[model samples]
Target: MDKRGRRRTLSEHVILDAALALLAEGGADAVTVRGIAARVGVAPNAVYTYFPDKAAVVRGLAEHLLGRVNHDRFTDPSQPWRDRVRALALELRAELLAHPGSVHLMLGHPPDGPHTRAVRETLLATLADAGLGPADAADASYLVNVHILGSVAFEVAAPPGGPDVGTTRFRWGLDRLLDGLAAHVATGPPR
Candidate 1:
């Protein structure tokens, strides 16, 4: 306000949007504090007011993106555990693939926001409902998350001109994982 006589204001959402734009334009390395500040028409130092550092900005962007995931599907009490897990996994995979530029960024820093937590909690609950013990449920949820993130990263890294394989590969892998989980549940806890 002193230098340009204009109001000095920056919202977290605005900063995150600009950062995301920078990310899309290049990659993770493109989304620097200076880059985001320039995009927002503010001094580089101004960005610090909203984000302490570049990592915070990246995390903000991740949260903003993950916030778009529809978790209501995980809330249905009547849905079978397998169906619920598969539905959520497929939806997450599609969402990640839609933002190809972000798949890599997300792999390093998984979402820890409230919405992300809700998704994780729901998955844990589904596993518990499937008769997994508390420890097993926690382990299973971690495995599912890893599979989704790892699969998306793999698909995004494929050659740009390669044939579109749809999701047969993903579905096949997911089915095998679910089969294993089913078998594990059927056997009860190890003696």
Candidate 2:
């Protein structure tokens, strides 16, 4: 039973929700098995039934959060490649900023889940559409990820004037990256 005296179901999703709430309330350190179990109206051992350890719980949280990022815009054939990439970067930034407390999880513990793979594949495809061969697309994808994650990590750590300022800076960096990519693609692989 919960604090309201209502019976609560114990499940992976329930545990994850508790973890997210704890993370939002007090950052990653607050998201422990006991904390989650208490929030979910269960014992610490019960949480272990769903997740073997704290690492697994953190992984689950990462997967759950990354699963929420929308990658559909990256697949829209109508848009130019830069526009598609921009949409993806913007959406990822918005999602990360939405959960400032959890941003570190993304940087420190890259989720190895279906959603993460999907986002990677989508970004690779989008780069390929921009005239990158497979090898170049892979390298470009790494650069793009670094830019987005690095920018968001910095913003979350030391927020600029406001979101607008951070976004403006993000756009400028992304544009420069795209411009370089355009030139590289136009010139073809170097000798």
What TM-score would candidate 1 get against the native? 0.89
In order, the Cα lDDT scores of the candidates are: 0.81, 0.86
- Residue 22 lDDT in candidate 1: 86
Q: Candidate 1 residues 55-170, lDDT tens each? A: 77777788887777888867686888899999988988888777766777776666677877878888888888888888988888888888888788778777888755458888
Write the residue-wise lDDT of candidate 2 on 67-92 in tens digits: 88878657987789999999899888
Off by over 4 Å in 1: 1-5, 163-166
Superposed by TM-score, candidate 2 places the C-alpha of residue 55 at a distance from the truth, in angstroms, of: 1.5
